[model samples]
Target: MNLSRPLDSAGGTDDSLGGSLAFGVVKSERQRVGVLAVLIVLLIAALLWSVFGPVVMQPELREKVRASLPFGIGMLTVMFLYECTSFGWLTQLIRKGYEPVYWVRVVNAVIEPLFFTAVLAFLIVFVGPLNGMAGPAPYIYFPYLALSALSLSLRLSLVSGITAAIGFNVAAFFAVHGLEATPSTAVLVSFPHYGMKGILIVLTGLAAGYVGHRLRKQLGESLKVARERDRAVSIFGQHVSPSVADRLLHQSVELTGEERQVCVMFVDIRDFSNLAAAKLPGEIVEYLNQLFGPMIQVVNDHGGIVNKFLGDGFMAVFGAPSEDLKLARNAVACAREILSSTDRLVAAGEIPPTRLGIGLHVGVAITGNVGSEQRKEYTVIGDTVNVAARIEQATKQFRAQLLVSDAVAEQCGPDVAGAVDLGLVELKGQPKPVHLYQLV
Candidate 1:
C-alpha cells in the first residue's frame, strides 16, 4: 500500500490550499471595484460643485458652465460604462479559470488619460473660445502616468503615456492653428514651449515605465516565494505536525539523515485478514479509511509523525526531523488515544468490534528521507524500528492490547507508572531476552 496517498485523496491539502488562494483573488478584485466606485462618486461630486458654484456666484458664467456640462456628463458616462464592463470581464475570466488578458490592463491604463485628454480638448475648442479663458490644459499626464506606473506593467504604462502625449499635442495643434479667428504672433512664440512639454511627456512615460517594470519583477519574485512555501507546507503537513512542517520549510531543522533517540510506534489491526476475507474489496477500503482517519489525527495531535503505512498498520515516530524531549510519553499518549477512539467507534456501530496491537520502543535510530531519486519518503530505520515491530507481534502471545519495551516505560515517567511488567521476553531473531511492559 502507498502510505503517501492520503485517506481522503479527493480533498487533500493541495485542493484546500488552491481553494483558499482562489478565494483571496476574488476578495482582492471585489475590493478594487469598491475603491473604484468611491472614486467615481467623489469625481461626480466635484464636477457638480464646479458647475453649480459658478452659476450661482456670477450669472454671466452660467452659459460657459452649461456648455461644459455636456462634455463632463459624456466623459463620466463613458468612464462608468468602461468600469462596469471591465469588472464584469474580470469576474468572467476568474469563473472560467483563466487570467484576464493584458489588453484588459492596457484598457484600464489608457482609458482615464484618454478621457482626460478629451475633456481638455472640449475646454480648448468649445469652452475656451466662448469664454476666452483657456491657456494650456492642466498637466493631467503626470498624475495619471504615475497611477499607471504603480498599477500597470511597463509596456502598458509606456503605451498609455505615449497615447496621452499624442492626444494632447493633437488638441493643442487644433486649438492654436484651427480654432483661433485672428492669427497672432504670440502663438508662434509659444510653440517652442508647447513642444518642450511634449518632449517632457515622453520622458516621463519612459521613467515611469522603468519603475513599473522593476515593481512588477519584484512582485513576481515575492509571489513565487510565497507559492513555494505554500506548496511545501501542503505537501509536508500531511505526514507531520504543522509546527514540524513549518520548521522544515524554514530550514530550522536538518532533513538529512541523522542519528537520534526516537520513540518508534507500530499499530496493527488484529485479525484484519479475516475481516478482509469476509467483505468486498470496496468495503475493506472504506473500513480502512474509517479506521486510519482518526488514528492518524491522534498521532499528529500528540506530535508523532506517521512515517509509513503497512498493509494493515502504520509506523509512527516521535522525535525525527525535529526533536522532542518527551517523545516516549507522546507516543504512549497517542496509542492510548487511538485505543479510546476505536472503542467509541465500535460503540457507535461505525465499525465491527475490533482490536489493535500497539507497540512502542525508545532507542537510537537513523532518521531522514529514504528511497530513490525519483521518489523519496521521510522515515526512520534501525534496531529501534525493528524492536517496535517485534513488540507489536508479541501482543498476540501475551493477549495484550498495548506493549512497550523497558526503555519506553522508563522514559515515559509517571504516565506509565501503573503499567504491568512482562519480564524477560524472548523476541524472535534476537539473541538476548528483552524486558516488556503492558498497559492494563
Candidate 2:
C-alpha cells in the first residue's frame, strides 16, 4: 500500500533566523556609523569653539589655545580617519557574512582602547597643561570601561580595560614630568597616585568583564533554544498542520500513543497502473502532482491531515493531534472538493481524465509516534484505518467514486448532502456487515 506523507512547507526556520541575524548585524553597523558621524561632528564643533572662544571671552588664554590648535587638529584628524576605517571594515564584514568571528570581536576590543589612549596622550602632551585643563584627564577611564563592557566578550573587555589603565598612567606620568621644575620628588609622589588609579581600572575591568560574560552566556542559551524550537516547528510542520506543529513544539500535548475518535480517509486513483504503463516516468509523476496537489490543499483547508501517500493514493486523518467534533463533516466536504478539483484539472487538459475512489470512516484509533527509536512517524492505526482502506477497495467493485461507513455518514449529520445509502454490505475481514453510503 502506498502512503502519502504531508507535503513539506516552502521554507525552514534556519532561513528565518538567518535573515533576522543578518538584519540585526546590518542595523548594528548602521548605528555604529551614525554614532561615529555624530562624534566627528561634535569634535569639529569643539575644535571650532576652542579656537574662537578664547579670542572672544578669555583673551589671556588666546595664545595658549592657539598653541594647542595644531595638536587638537591632529588628534581630531586621527580619530576621524579611524572611525571611517572602522566603518569601512564593518561594511565589508557584513558584505561577506554576519557571523560574529573572534577576530572581529578582538578588533573591536582593541580599537576603542587604542583611540582613547591616543586622546589621553594628546591631552597630556599638548591640550591639558598648554590650555590649563588637566584635571579631567584622570576621569576618562570610567566611560572607557563602560563602553568596553558593551562588547560582550570578557577577554576583549578586560583587554580594553587594562590598555586604558596603562595608557592613563603613561599619560599622567608625562603630564607630571612636564609640570615638574624638579623631577625627582614629583616623579616619586606621582607614581603612587597613578598606581592607585591603575588598580581601580583593573578592578573595574574585572567587574565589567564578569557581568558581560554572564549576560553573553545567557543570551547564547536563549538563542539556542529559539533555534531548536524553530527547527522542530519546521520538521513537524511537514507531518501536521502549522498550528498543530507549533503546539507540539511547545509541549502542549504528549506525542505518546493514545486512542482517540478520529475520521480516517483513503483516496486511490483508479486505473493508475494502466496510466503509468502508458506514460513516461516523468509524465506519470507530473500527472500525479497535478492530481495530488489540489487534493492535499482541499484536505488541509477542511482541517484534515494528509497522513500518508500510498503509491497511487493518500490517507487523511482528522482529530488525531487535537480533537475535532466536526471531523466527519470536514472529511466529507474535503472529498467533495477533491472530486471537483480533479474534474477541473482533467477538463483543463492539465491531467488526463481519471477516476478516484475515496473511503472515510469514523472511530476510535491508536494515534501517535510509531516506529523504531531512530525513526518514528506520527500516524493513526487500528480497525478504523483498515476499514477505510477496505471501503476504498469496495468502491471499485461498486463502481462508485466515494464511499463512507454508516459511522462516518452519521457523524457527518446533514453535511453529507445527496448521499445514497448502499445498504448493509460485509467489508473484507469483518465478521459483521456495515451500512455504506455513496456520495452523489
Top TM-score model: 1
Error of 2 at 54 (Å): 36
Q: List the residue pairs that clash in candidate 2.
A: 2-309, 2-310, 2-311, 3-308, 3-309, 3-310, 4-308, 4-309, 4-310, 5-309
Instruction: Give one digit per residue, the lDDT tens place, for model 1 in 1-440.
Output: 22122212332443444433433443344345445545555565666776675434355455665677787667766776766775676566556444443465566667666776776777765565323224333365676566555553567768877888877777666656544344554554344555667778877877888886786566656656787887888787776556557755564233477899999999999999998999999998999999999998998888788878898999988987678899999999999999999999999999988999999999999976556555555668999899999999999999899999999898987899899989989988777888999985
Against the unseen true structure, what C-alpha lDDT does each candidate score?
0.73, 0.72
TM-score of each: 0.61, 0.60
Candidate 2 regions off by >4 Å? 1-150, 153-191, 199-256
Q: Number of clashing residue pairs in every model?
A: 0, 10
Residue pairs with backbone atoms closer than 3 Å in model 1 (clashes): none
